[model samples]
Target: MLSMPLRLRPGDDLRGAIEAVLREHGAAFVLQGIGSLSVARLRFAGRPQPDVLAGDLEILTLAGSVSPDGAHLHMAVADAAGRVSGGHVAPGCIVRTTAELLVALLPGHVFAREHDSGTGYPELSIRPVPQASAS
Candidate 1:
């Protein structure tokens, strides 16, 4: 396992940045994240669409798994008034100031997303990396 500390700058897409890391590492899990965001788009529980929160928002918590296919992240944020809201992290969550994240990279493993008939959504699939044979 490789632990990576990442810092995201302003105007960066939260999900996109994590996805980039996943693309490089193959499989990684976001242990935690703390930062500020100018815009947060989150899909509440059982909601088909994401609610957009515009303004200065503090990232209370962020964690999830990211695979080569995609990422499943959950985040909680507090508004300037201290109102807290959390849900499934979606795209377009723009960083306002900075984002600090600790990611754990899993070697010798591969993560894929497959369609789950029961859930009607794509889910994570874990498998060991195939061993390479010497000629």
Candidate 2:
């Protein structure tokens, strides 16, 4: 397991920036943990409305995984109000305060994105990689 501390600057899209980090790192192998992100957008499944979060909202919880290409990410975020929301992250979520993230890289694991016949959204697929492989 690896821990990463990330601070999103003002005007930075919370989810997009996270995915960018994964891309910069190549393949994570595994996303073991994340915590404390301020002013994030939480999109709920089955609901068209997305919550634009900001200000003193303690990150109640966060859960998600990154795609093998590192360009896509799926996550759930709950704010201080105890309301939980998540979905296919879009842009425009600015970091009002700061975001600190913890990520784990699994050297032997690989996560990729493929279109699902049912959902139509790119879904994550996991596979094992040779120890020396990079993607």
Candidate 3:
């Protein structure tokens, strides 16, 4: 396991930024830390359009696993008014001030998303990573 601390600058796309890191490793990883954002684009369950929240917002919680192929993350945030909102994380969430994050890399595990008949949505599938043979 490896811990990665990330700080996203202003105007950076939140989800897209994280996706870049996932693509960098192209492996299993999870976000595990608190962060703050000035802007956010969150999509509620079954909602067509994501709500674009503006102004300082405290990142209360972020939970999900990611792979280079895709990511499934949920987030909750508290606005400047202290009104809390949460939903499925989506792209186009531009950062305002900054976004501090701690990403954990699971080198021994592999993650992927596949269309599931039961869920009727792309769901995350996790498994152990294959061992590499000696050269």
Q: What is the lDDT of every predicted structure here?
A: 0.95, 0.60, 0.79
Tell me model 3's lDDT, rounded to 2 decimals: 0.79
**Consecutive 10-residue window with the lowest summed lDDT within model 2:** 25-34
How good is model 2 by TM-score? 0.65
- Model 3 Cα lDDT, one tens digit per residue, 1-135: 888888888888878888887775645455654677777789998898888888888888876778878777788999888999999888877777777878888878777788999979888777787788899
- Candidate 2 per-residue lDDT, tens place, 1-135, comes to 455655666566766777777765434532433445556565666767666666544443444676546445445566677776666455656655555666766556667888899988777777776666588
Model 1 spans with C-alpha error above 4 angstroms: none
lDDT of 1 at 7: 97
Tens digit of per-residue lDDT, candidate 1, span 18-100? 89867766789999999999999999999999999999999999999999888999999999999999999999999999999
**RMSD, each candidate, Å?**
0.9, 4.5, 1.9
Off by over 4 Å in 2: 29-40, 48-57, 68-88, 131-135
lDDT value for model 1 = 0.95
- TM-score-better candidate, 1 vs 2: 1
Deviation of model 2 at 29, angstroms: 8.2
- Which has the greatest lDDT? 1
